[model samples]
Target: MNTFCLEVSGPFACFTRPEMKVERVSYDVITPSAARSVFEAILWKPQIRWRITRIEVLNPIRWINLRRNEVGAVVSTRNVQQAMNAGSGYLGLDIEDERQQRAGLFLRDAAYRLHAELALSPKANDPLVKYAEMFSRRATKGQCVNQPYLGCREFAADFRLVAASAAERPAIDETRDLGWMLHDLDFTYPCAPQPRFFRAEMKNGVILVPDFETGEVKS
Candidate 1:
């Protein structure tokens, strides 16, 4: 496997639980998909995909409550399609009319070390090392297609390539059973929502993430 690691940290994060229909509740630790997103931010290619293997919590998990403003209604694709079909060529959502306040339980001062590997698609022609080196070089130089966020884009995350020596440092001395958490989404169409969950346990501050193909993830 072509493997690499990154150290990611953020002031706040909210990996919203699927069960929370009303209020947002964050997972005890970052999810595999979220970790993959950090890597995707640095570099992404259609020929390669990321698989998060493990996560190390460098700082103690701290919880904080917040009430954030959000829009209750959104302009969906159907709305845009309808507008285009009618030749109106215009659509708008008044935030003031749809604005809502929601509570969220988020993690504060969160930091994690991500370990992941790449899987080259059948169409890929180059060796895995080439892409691995590309990612490492991009990360080291602080290059990214977009700014990586922890969970919410408002809570931005800072990430960098880990050094071989400093990478060996252990995570915070702690352990806990985090219960079933969202593993990843199975998008039926263009990033549509279909969530999967898995039993989460943190041992010595390290969380083991399952591969997407594993039976551990439940719909």
Candidate 2:
């Protein structure tokens, strides 16, 4: 399998815990899904899927508290469909009426090195080298389909491509258990999406990600 590496850094990040409904709380480190998203932002194709293999934490984990005004409600899907069909029903969120101040705990001055491999689907026709070169070229030129974020769109991430051998190792030496962290959401059955989680442990500032298929993920 052909693998790639990227170094990502940001001023702040918030990998929000789904279990925390009221207050936004982030995981100690970046999740596998978030790492994969960073790669996809640089290069993604329907026929190719990016799988995160490991995350090297280059900065010590630190937390900061922030409070921001957010809208309480999202645009209703039913209302959107009604508007599309008959040009009726409210489709916009009333921030004045649904504004709420929420507290968020986010990572401060975060930096990580992400390692991932490309898995070609059956529909893929191009050779692996073609896609790999494309990604490398794009990344070197600072090109992305969209600005990659650190869990949240408001927090933009800086990314650069690096050789797998030259990638930086973790800066910390402590072994800490991160508890159960979100792996990704399974959407094979679209109507009922399944959330998967795995036990996370950071050893020597490196968080090793397991295979999605064989990894022990609890729904």
Candidate 3:
């Protein structure tokens, strides 16, 4: 397996807990799915899949409260489809009328080191040397198809390739259980998405991720 490490940091992040539907509440640390998204932002293809193995918390967990103005309603998809088909009616959302203020609890001064492995699907052309080198080159050059964010687009993440030997030591030392956290979403059946979760624990600032297929994941 070809593995890689990346150092990612941001001023603010909110990996919103699914259970918290009204107000935004973030996880103590980065989730496996969020870490995988960062990698995918750097380099992604249908043939190549990135699997997160571990997340090392490089900074102490801190929380901050913030209030943001957000629109409450979404533009109806039916309206959008009707406009696309018949070119009539309003399909845009009016923020001034629907805007609402909401409170959010987010992680402040967050930093994490991600470790992941790459797997090639049957559609891959050159499984070993092709995509691996492409990802390494893109990461070193700070090239991402889109700007990577911690959880929200407003909080941008800075990423760079880090050697395993030179990786920074995690600042946290105590062991704590983070309870059940989101692992990733299963999109195999696109019509019906499935949410998967696993028990999360942090030991010496490292959160080990279980295999998506074999691990103790609940949907």
Query: In terms of lDDT, which candidate is strongest?
Result: 3
Model 2 Cα lDDT, one tens digit per residue, 141-189: 9999999999998989999887764535645777899999999889889
Clashing pairs in 2: none
Give lDDT tens digits, candidate 3, residues 5-98.
9999999999999999899999999999999999999999989989999888988899999999989999888889988899788877889999
RMSD of 2: 1.6
Global Cα lDDT for candidate 1 = 0.89
Model with the higher lDDT, candidate 1 or 3: 3
lDDT of 3: 0.91
Candidate 1 TM-score to native: 0.92
After superposing candidate 3 on the true structure, give the runs of residues whose Cα lies further than 4 Å from its correct spot: 87-89
Instruction: Name the 10 consecutive residues with the lowest summed lDDT in model 2.
Output: 163-172
User: How large is the C-alpha RMSD of every model relative to the true structure?
Assistant: 1.9, 1.6, 1.4
For each candidate in the order shown, give its overall lDDT on alpha carbons: 0.89, 0.88, 0.91
- Give per-residue lDDT, candidate 2, residue 188: 86
Q: Please tell me which predicted candidate would have the highest TM-score against the true structure.
A: 3
